[model samples]
Target: MTIVLIGYMASGKTSVGKILAQKLNYKFIDLDDFIEEKEHATVKDIFKNKGEIYFRKVETQYLNELLALSNDNIVLSLGGGAPCFGNNMNEVLDSSTATSVYLKGSVPFLSNKLIKKKIKRPLIAHIETVEQMTEFVGKHLFERIPFYSKAEKHVLIDNKSKPEIAEAIIAQLF
Candidate 1:
């Protein structure tokens, strides 16, 4: 079945997903990359230009369409907040042959990893101080955990190598 990896920002979804896909010989799809490809812009740019609501609508539409076309062997890496909003979470649970996997990590781990990147992460970009970042990571991760915990499986990832984590997940699922 398709593997849907969901978690907070900087939680290694994309990295571990690629490794898993390679090991399993499946196609790897980052949901953000799919949206970006369709929009011809970065996710941050899409949010800035069309507003978050618009992008979310597009995302919902894409999710439905993808579900209709999915098979039992692709890897889908979802956005950090994708499963927590709207009815998308319920839809994911009901539709497709997708197995949801929550990549669990600590707030301190995420903060340390994301602090160095100046990328399309709009929410955490302005928090420059370590204290602010720590709080940001804590609050965001905490709020999202309730939703994330509903995934079919949970995997703790404590700064291990991507291949090791991928191997563990494959061993579990296969």
Candidate 2:
């Protein structure tokens, strides 16, 4: 079975997913990294060069490719916006052996975490302050929750270590 982690930026999907996969003895795949390897460009460059529409199209294509693999026993960390576009959410939800988990984090938690890593993120790189980051997370999260909430499981990630969050997910999965 595949464990799919979905969430907004800074929600710890990639970090916790890595730990979760380790504990479960499963392979770990970060979708964005896979895309970068496949396309030979960073996601930011994909957005800049070909634009978001093209990126979203390729994102769905890659998502489908990953999901269709047989007996992979993988933990997949999706891009923050992956499920929010096109029919991607439905595709994930319909996958017979995939369990989709949303790493639910509050705006404050996300804002605080994102502030420290904004330079690595193209979307919020220009955010000037914590207040602005908070505002951006709040609004963007509101828009994405409909897609995120469709996940089979939801794990609250506030005030938790990565291992603790991984444990919570493991508990939920079993």
Best TM-score among the predictions, by candidate number = 2
lDDT of 2 at 75: 96
Which residue pairs clash in candidate 1? none
- Candidate 2 error regions (>4 Å): none
- Candidate 2's displacement at residue 59, Å, is 0.6
The residue-by-residue lDDT of candidate 2 on 61-136, one tens digit each, is 9999999975799999998999999999999999998999999999999999999999988789999999999999
**lDDT by residue for model 1 (1-174), tens:** 778888988888999999999999988889889999988998888888999898899888777666666655788898988898788777778865878888888888778788877355767778787677888889888888888999888888877888988987887787
lDDT, candidate 1, equals 0.83
Estimate TM-scores for all models. 0.93, 0.97
Candidate 1 local Cα displacement, residue 71, angstroms:
2.9
C-alpha RMSD in Å of predicted model 1 compared with the true structure: 1.5
**Residue 18 displacement in candidate 1 (angstroms):** 0.9
